[model samples]
Target: MNNTHLHLVVNHLPIIFPVVGIILLVIGIFTKTEVSKRNSYFIFILGALASIAAMATGEGAEEGVENLPGVAESLIETHEEAAELFAGLSYILGGISTVALFASFRNYIFSKIMPFTVVLFALATLFFAQKAGTTGGEIRHTEISSTGTSQIIGEDIKKESNHHDKE
Candidate 1:
């Protein structure tokens, strides 16, 4: 409905697509299949595009959540920083994928070497994606947050008791 909602919808794309890409790329390399590797590159390109969409919607999402009673600005900021890094990695992967795609189609010598670099990039992207996902979860999912989990549970219990007393 809103930017924040859109952000939530699209955020997982950046995380999940790379995983599929990595798997496909590995399988392609192992089996000597150009089509699978090309598909992997295409997925990486899609993931990079999704990362852009996510980042575009992120500021509004932050605005929506930052003032919520249990949300922390610090967590949002951390997530933002992590998202930036993740997006950068995606962009780099996209570039490599493009080059590899072209090289593969042309049967260039570089295509043979591209998979190793792609694996490195994919691993790096995967690592940052995990960090981004965790930090993003903590933005609103207080139960999973490092600092606020216990406090949030305590607050929930207190609220329940207060409601019972009033009833």
Candidate 2:
């Protein structure tokens, strides 16, 4: 499949997988199950890898779509910025997940702290995830963008163009 196609398929994983992982982690914490914790860690790691894939394909996706009608560079820039934030947070989560996985295996003395730490990280990750998703959606979804909820950067050009057209 093309890079845009590949990106569409994998981009959601970073947004979705960590949510599932967070749930599993919470359950693991509540139930005191190493298996669940391990699984959560694995899921987070996968999410991180997927984030890399999505980031790698992003340029190709941009190249494929940036010139299309109604596709604003501002929207792309917004999405790109949000994506960078998401990716950085996701990588941190991945590192934490790996450490937590190992901690589960060895029953680390400070193991109790890891889950709480992950929970905090997940919350922040989730915030960025939502931002990325919304900005990315605005890239093409005019319905969402029409409400002036647009996070698109460089919007002045769009406004100026619209104003000129109306004259």
lDDT of 2: 0.89
lDDT of 1 by residue, 11-94 (tens): 999999999999999999999998999999999999999999999999999888888898878788899999999999999999
TM-score of 1: 0.90
User: Lowest summed lDDT over 10 consecutive residues: which window, candidate 1?
Assistant: 142-151
Q: How many clashing residue pairs, candidate 2?
A: 0
lDDT of 2 by residue, 26-106 (tens): 999899888988899999999999999999999999999899867888889989999999999999999998998898789
Q: By TM-score, who's the top model here?
A: 1
**Angstrom error at residue 6, model 2:** 1.0
User: Runs in model 1 with CA error above 4 Å?
Assistant: 153-167
